[model samples]
Target chain A: MAAIILLGLNHNTAPVELRECIAFSEEDTELALEELHERTEFKEILLLSTCNRVELLLVTDDRETCVAEAKQFLAEHNRVPLDDVEPALYVHEGADAIRHVFRVASSLDSMMVGEPQILGQIKSAYRTATQKKTSGVILNRLLHRAFFVAKRVRSETGIGDHAVSISYAAIELGRKIFGTLEGKEVLLVGAGEMAELAVENLIRHHAGTIWVANRTFERGLELATRFGGRAIRLEEIPESLQHVDIIIGSTGATDLVITSDHVRAIMRRRKNRPLFFIDIAVPRDIDPAINRLTNCYVYDIDDLKEIIDENIEDRNREAIKGERIVEEATIRFSQWCDSLAVVPTIVALRRKMEDIIDEQIDKTLGGLKHFSETDREAFDRMKQALINKMLHDPTMFLKSNGCLGDRSLYLDVTRRMFNLDNER
Target chain B: MENLRYLIILLYLASTVSYLLYLFIQKDGFHRAGIYLLIAGVGIHSAEILYATVSSGQLPATNLYDALSIAAWAIALVFLVIQFRYKIRILGIFAAPLAAMVTILSTRLPETPIPAQNIFNSIWFIIHIVSVFIGDAALALACGVGLLYLLQEHAIKAKKRGFFYSRLPSLELLDTTGYACIVVGFTMLTIGLITGFVYAKAIWGRFWSWDPKEVWSGITWILYAVLLHERLTVGWRGRRAAIMAIVGFCVVLFTFFGVNFFMKGHHGQFTTF
Candidate 1:
């Protein structure tokens, strides 16, 4: 029988500071994974390191040995005490471990459930393990099945629909005003992390025209270069604003940059087509009074935050569907594990019984039963019937009850009562 | 013949009631009832047209109002035919209102015997009327789908979750349907216009009179023509095509009723004359 052990921490278990400590830089994650695999007890290991989680997928024989090895591996790498890591860690074994892996890979365990990137992360890790030749029969099968299950959940349910992050919320808000983002222009303000994320969300939605504007022009250039967008300086924003249908502002300015006057001028040039302005800045970079203008819609940080929070609630509503999928996969995996566990015992018992039957039948018929043809035929029939009747009940009972872990005690009792021996 | 005419109106009213029921509560009983109501209405409409033609020795398109009402009924009947073929039950969401409006108005018009007009004698009138109704039917179907597409798309992008997640088709499928309808509609419309040219030359003694109805009809044709070209050649699907289809239908409705209601032209007396 095989067992899996999962040990990881996520947004729920750890503070941001702690989870950030173990977080791998994009360039460093592969090397880190290779180093983590050096533990003797961690035979087949996959490292699922993401922004919100750092899970170790291990296929090991002994639960306690594997757990200790995982804790030690993390402690040594981060230079943290093992005791300090305990409170922030979770340890799930056997059926629980398999379910956790599926959930994590499917993004059901993500801070934002159904984020869609975790499945790719899981696939990358699986490929790395395959390249290293560290994966065996069980893990290879488990992971391949996990991909299908992940796809099933996505195709059958709307768990992955909608955006939950501040960036995704901005993109969604833009879509509401625009009705569609195809070929629509987006003016991203101040090249911040939020702006970069907004760019990601917009690009994914097929918004083609992206303009990045920042106070320090290089920062804008850097983000624009990454996202294939046009970079603009703050002074050039008014000219940029006239062409763009959407504007996302999250700058470090102490005062407002876009006033009612600037907006009125932009609206006049565009002939009153709809414009969506999102202000993600703290202390508000865009003038709040501009919302009074017709055809100009403005949402400040709090307003955008409310939408993001609502997305989180929407995710919770869909999680009920995701949970149903995970629960079904868990029960099936557990049954397979239990059935696998009783296989050796069943094989050993059958081999022992056959040997005893062979010895007695040979001794009785090999020489002493060679009297007449009818007598010899009768002896062979009796010998076969006894063996058939002997093995039927035990085999049937072992397979079904074995899957539930209840057959182990009975097998032990049978072994003692029959005096089953390996030397035979 | 009289019974069939009355039956057409009855079936149209039944369809309207059932569609309203479907809108309020989307259950199997209402959906099935709507489907049966539409099928029955189409049958009655067809029977009434067939009986009127057979009894009076009159072509279906005898006068302007007779032609207008017949064209509207043909559009509804064609939509119902497609619905029966595809079993596309969602079409009732838009089709019922169209059918009821056409049938109810058909009843209100003067029941005076209309002698066959000289314009209705030309072969172009048949093609023009058939093509126009065919295109109108496709546009009506597209509007039905556009409504569903927006509903599904909104539910998804809003992060709001529930049964809508399961009921709606993918955005890709909706896009394909929208593009397909516009293409079919545009082809029929082009033929309708070409035939209208021949019919105008035959009866009105001119190739381009620029009647207000004709002007608006040409504008309507150009709107959908550009939409079709954009969708097929430029890959305009989903949102843009949806918006265009909706706008195009508004133009069609105005061409059907607005010009008839307000403007005085060859098409103004569409239902009264």
Candidate 2:
């Protein structure tokens, strides 16, 4: 019998330094898949390499030999010593391996449990494995099941609904205020990394007309060019405030970049259109007092962090629901794998019964020389009926017991009683 | 006919239950079920109105009972239109209960018959009653939207992220929908009042009756007119606009019921309590 095996190290088991050392690039993954396919021992293979984890899933008849050979191959391919990498490695076989893959695909095994990028990464890995022709029937079914389970977990549960990062939280808050971000103007108060990240998320929502305001005109222009937006000097922020709906402030200024009075004066010209300010800077580029102004909202770094923290708690609660779905799918998949074992046994038993019955009928016909052609045909028909009737009970018994805990024990007993493996 | 009216009320009550389930459970299935029930209720209610009109050789709103029934039908019909256009299923929480309540109230009132008069037979009176009822329905929805806007605004401004925060829509959408309702209601009210004057002149020999209903209707019209003027000119929107919408709806309610119950009016002949 063939067993599904998984050998991998993730962020939980390995440090970034070690994971990076063994992580395979796309070309390296393709090459490694081809190399692994060259060995007759590995019947099917797939390699999933991402920033946080490196996993190799395989199907093999000889588990011990395959595990040793795969570990050795990993050491040689990445040029890392066995002792240095062996402690970080974890291996799963049979049902454990299937559950691990399901959890990984559903993102329950991620560093951030509800993050969505890992499923796309797994899909790309599966695509590469298919292109290399390293994934066979069992693996193809398993990968597709993984995708289905992942989709079920996403829709049936709220695991991926909330934002757990700073930039995402800012966008979530902005959506609450504006109903939608489409065609809403965004002003990047400085070229700070956090503000830039928030703007990137805003642009993803189709926010219109990006404006970058920096103390230095050239720096602002450079950042604005990247977003296909216009640059403005710091002095012009008050004038630009009339049109812009959202302002993201992450400048390095010690003093406040925007004051309450400035926003107060612009609120009339802006026709009381809502203003959202995301202050990600350390010194707080936007004034806290501006939050009190009508139709104006200000969220600083701490506020964003608070929202993220609350959202993370929500995600954690939702993840419990996802785990239940994963558990149900895993049991269903294992039952399917167990059923695969039942089919060939039933076929072998029927074939054995037919061979014995046919041999006896031929021997009897040869002894009777006066037997008519019609009688011979009737004898052949009786032989088939006899074999079918004899095997029907055993086949039914095996199938009925297929989902039991001692299913393999029953199969072993039946195989022994029938002497079904004598030829092998 | 009475059995059909009972069935309509039952369907409206069922719709109210479904919408309430949707609000608390936040399920799309319940919301869809609510919409279907409301549609069935409105369809039967329309047939009932047509039946009463054909049976009596005049408009159906001859007394408080019939007028309230038509009012409920108008509100449900307008709600169906708004739900189809905006896809704002949350608004059903307000609309379904209000329709159900009005339907129940119509059944509770005693049917009083005035002396047979040619005034009730006038085409102008029919036009006046239909437009006024529909206009009142639209303004009622505006009040509901205004309440939602204030709730959402309070949730956002408080920064507490409470239960209503996620349930209510954004302030901008509520404000825009409220403004649309006001514009539609204002236009229909203007038409109703104009036709009302024509009907009054044909019957009472003058357009300006100084009746309580007429006075209150003028007051309600001017309130909405000012609201529209300010919203268009100075952009009095968001919280302020929401508050004005609610206030204007109160005046409309007073004109619809309060003037008849509290003060004598020429329109009192149309609805006897």
Candidate 3:
């Protein structure tokens, strides 16, 4: 196995104060990458510096020495003493390091397990490393495989589905109803914080028309202008409801601001088009009875929380699937590494056999001076057949089982028998 | 010729299995291989038909066996062309099995060819048979697509969000393609009916006969006409249009097979089965 050294401190292993101290700035990272290439014996190095974690991934021939040197480099670069930083550092070597890289790229180890930003952060780290000439063939293949595993985790499981926050839940429910928010209209019944949050999420999903109505006209105008929507008076809510498909209400009101009668009239004017209501206020602003009307749906604060809770649970379940995918990809990548390791031996053995056959054929043809063209062809065919039959079993066995376990002794004996080591 | 027909059946079977694999796996490799296999089957099928036609000195669609075989071939050919035009690869999952099933049924039919001196051997006879078979093939494909639409709709409505939900094409694409199939099928059926009327007048000295095959074909044609009319005028779409397509294909199948195999008619009486 190749030597992989991963030494870093994340939010899980270190306090925020220590993480901030250990984090690499852009200049610090570029200098460290350059210094490691110039001074250290490590073959490849990548520094991933984000707010939540600062990790150094190094590939070298000697795992123990490289892991120690990488930690010292981190300590010296961050201006921290070696003793204090060593206790905070977490180290993974070889296959564990590979798995860590995969899990990190797939976001399985993030503070938010299924968050999507970590993959982009890792990609940028890899891009910087590649641009600096710090990552070569091995690290390049490993990073690309990590990216692929992350993509597989994204598609094969519903890890990125559903919403983890209340406002996002409201938007996700809107998506479930309309399949997309691209052409749907949203009505913000008040300028409350949760309603504003919902509006932000709706805008992110590309909702078309937005109407903000509130009891206070100036406050409504401020919120509407902030979100690029129309500011309507409180009395105009009913008329706006006829045109909007979704209503997010979070006003601070004692009584229901939107009644079943108001919605019934709007429903009639809208000609029975579907309507969705998300009320996040205490003593909800919309009538609960309006939910029973045809093509009408109402979800209050508790319901939105329930959906978020379910979504978190769904993400946890999906994370388990993601872990399995990571393990599967890790095994595949390990096998590829193994095959790469044995390729040199396989090539040397085949060449040795071919060279011996070619020498034997040359000597025999030199001795047969009176042979006809057909006779010469027959002799060449016989020599080729002898060579193929002799090398077939050994070639198949070594190519298939060479990477199984410690078989260096067998490779050494074969090299000696063929005088390959003597040539070198 | 018989051996070549058998080889064609084997190739069709292989293509059908490959298409089934493509559907279940949803892999591009499986789909590409399935398409290649289907093309191979079509090539062998054309060769077998050509051989039969040359040896008999007539069109291969002279009996129930050959007619059904030609129908299957045309269906696969048209489906291949549509698949290339639209890139609706899942269409083959339905079309391949249909072609295979028709060829299988053709094998089970009697092998006796039509008599040489049959009065229905005119060019009008060839036109009527070819047009009607191609039309029926299109309607059958439409029926298959309609079934796929209903399956996808059911999956979405039930919120299964499973394989079928993700794998099936969009509802709008399926509906539009089904509509296109009906338009082409209906046009060909109109031509087939007109040619049949002309040939009937030339031979039986009448334009309209109360033959079971003719009457049922008229009923099938009228059902399709009503389906098209409703789709154009009343904005029939989605599930309603899908159900109509399936029902129209059912009527077509009854006219093509039930009338020929069970009832007495000028069309059925001529073909030895």
Candidate 4:
């Protein structure tokens, strides 16, 4: 039976300094994987190295010696001392290893739980492993199952649906109001860092032409040039409102920059198209009263924070559901691994029985050739049925849960009794 | 034939249950199950109506039972089309129950016997009934979309992030869907009223009637027309549009049911119990 082993260090176990020293670059990872496959007893090897975590998944017959060798190899490859690396390294074997892989792939084990980038990183790592031909049947099946479990967790739960950051919350809220930000015009007010970040996210959503308004003309022009948008004086914001559908306000202004009166007058001219105001300023750049206007929405910094906080809670709750999916997938994959153990014994026993039956049938039929072809055909059928009936109970016994506790014991006894090993 | 009607009701009921489950559980499987069940129900209901019309050599909606059945079928059919177009599966929470309720109500009411005068054979009458029922179905969907718009809008404005915020579609989608439904409904209603006038002229020897149904249909038409006019000229959209779509549907319901049940008119004779 092959033992599944996972040896790794993650953000949770090691500090950034230690992790950086131990991490492998893409080229280094491929080289390390090849060296490990050649030098170690590991039959299948996959090395996953991301900024936050580095994990080595291996399938081997000897667990103890292979794990020690892997640790030593990691120390030598990264030029780090074995004493420093050993403290941060964690090891998982058997079903626990499977569960760990599932959890990691699904983002439950991420430093920031439910972040989506980890899955992509793991996918790329798996792609490299497959490209190098270092991953075999067990590792390929395990990684594929991990990807499947990740997808199932994504669809079945809201783990990745909520936005935990301030800028992301703005985009999320914009989506809730506009359905799709595509082709929606955006106006950036005062050129604050937060507002620029929100604009960056909006541009990614394919938001149409951006307009920048600032207190100073030069700064506004520079910011507009950076975004490939037009720069306008602060007074032009009201007139610009006619075309702009989204306004992101993050200024140092103490007073409200966009009063409800300015928006009310422009709304009719704009034909009552919906306007979304994201106020990221501390004292509030847009008026709270604007939120009450028809076809207008205003969300200030505090409101965005509240949404992010609520979403974080939602993600935490959904992560619990995700963990359950991971658990179920882990149990299923482990059962498949367990069933793999019995296959060789079953095949060897069947082959041995068939060989003995074939030898007996040939000798008996050779002597009875003088009788008739019909008699020979009847004899062949009887011998086939005898093999099936004779091997049925032992095969079932080896495969069934009745021998699950001592499955290896049953396999060993059956192999010795049939003398299956020597026949092979 | 009656067993087929009962089966349709059962299918609609199952669809309604599935949609309600999807609303609470937010599961894709329940949503898919609801859609398939609704399609089946609509399919069988269409066949039943076609069978009735073929057997009688006239439109099936000559009586109240057949009219309600056709109305329910039209609602489900229109909803299915909208669902496919918009991918707004959550709207099924409302559309399915409404379809199921109308279908069940159709079976409970006693169906009036067909009139002997053969007025139902008029092509104008058939066109009018088909157009009116389909129009009402579109209006009904608009009402459902309107309700969803208000729910999502309130959730966003209030910043509550409650049960409906994530479950419902975006406010803009709901608003746009409502607008599309109203446009289609308003157009069909206009055609229905025109054909009805033609039918009235042929049978009653006059193009205009002061009958309760006629008066109410005219009122419903004017209401939607004003809404459409304002939407085009004055930019009355979003919340106002959603509210108007809902209010127009109320007038549509009154024209459809209230006029027939409470007031006596020439149209009542066709649908009389």
DockQ of 2: 0.59
Residues A191-216 of candidate 1 have per-residue lDDT tens digits of 57776677777788888778988888
Scanning candidate 4 chain A in windows of ten residues, the lowest lDDT window is: A403-412
C-alpha lDDT values of all predictions: 0.72, 0.88, 0.81, 0.88
Write the residue-wise lDDT of candidate 2 on B31-138 in tens digits. Answer: 989999999999999999998888788888878999999999999998898888777778888988899899889888887866567778999998999999999999
| Candidate scoring better on TM-score of 1 and 4 | 4
Residue A243's lDDT within candidate 2 is 92
The most accurate candidate by TM-score is 2
**Predictions' DockQ, in order:** 0.11, 0.59, 0.06, 0.75
Span of 10 residues, lowest total lDDT, candidate 3 chain A = A403-412
Global local distance difference test of model 3: 0.81
User: Tens digits of per-residue lDDT for model 3 on A1-424?
Assistant: 3566788988888889889898888878888899998855577889999988999888776777778788888888889999988888889876788899999999899887788999999999998899899886668878999999999999988888877888887766665455568868888887777678788888998998788888889988988888888999988888788889989888888999899999888765675556889889888899988877655678888877776677788889999999999999888766555544445766766677677777877787888788889987787687668767877776676556563432433454466577754545
Quality of model 1 by C-alpha lDDT: 0.72
- How do the predictions measure up, each by TM-score? 0.61, 0.89, 0.67, 0.82
Quality of model 4 by C-alpha lDDT: 0.88
| Fnat measured on candidate 3 | 0.00
> What lDDT score is found at residue B111 in candidate 2?
79
Runs in model 4 deviating more than 4 A are A1-5, A27-47, A56-87, A126-145, A155-157, A328-424, B27-29, B54-57, B60-62
Report model 4's chain A TM-score.
0.79
DockQ of 4: 0.75
lDDT of 4 at A223: 91
Runs with alpha carbons beyond 4 Å of true place in candidate 3? A1-4, A11-22, A31-45, A59-88, A102-120, A126-424, B50-58, B270-272
Number of the candidate with higher DockQ, 3 or 4? 4
lDDT of 4 by residue, A1-424 (tens): 6789999999999999989988899999999988887854777889999899989999887899999999998889889999999999999999999999999999999877789998999889999989988887778889999999999999889889888889999898889999999999999999777789889998899999999999999998999998888999998999999999999998899999999999999988888989999998888899999999988999988998899888888888999999999889988888667746788777777777778878988886677658687877787788778878987887888778796443555665676677765735
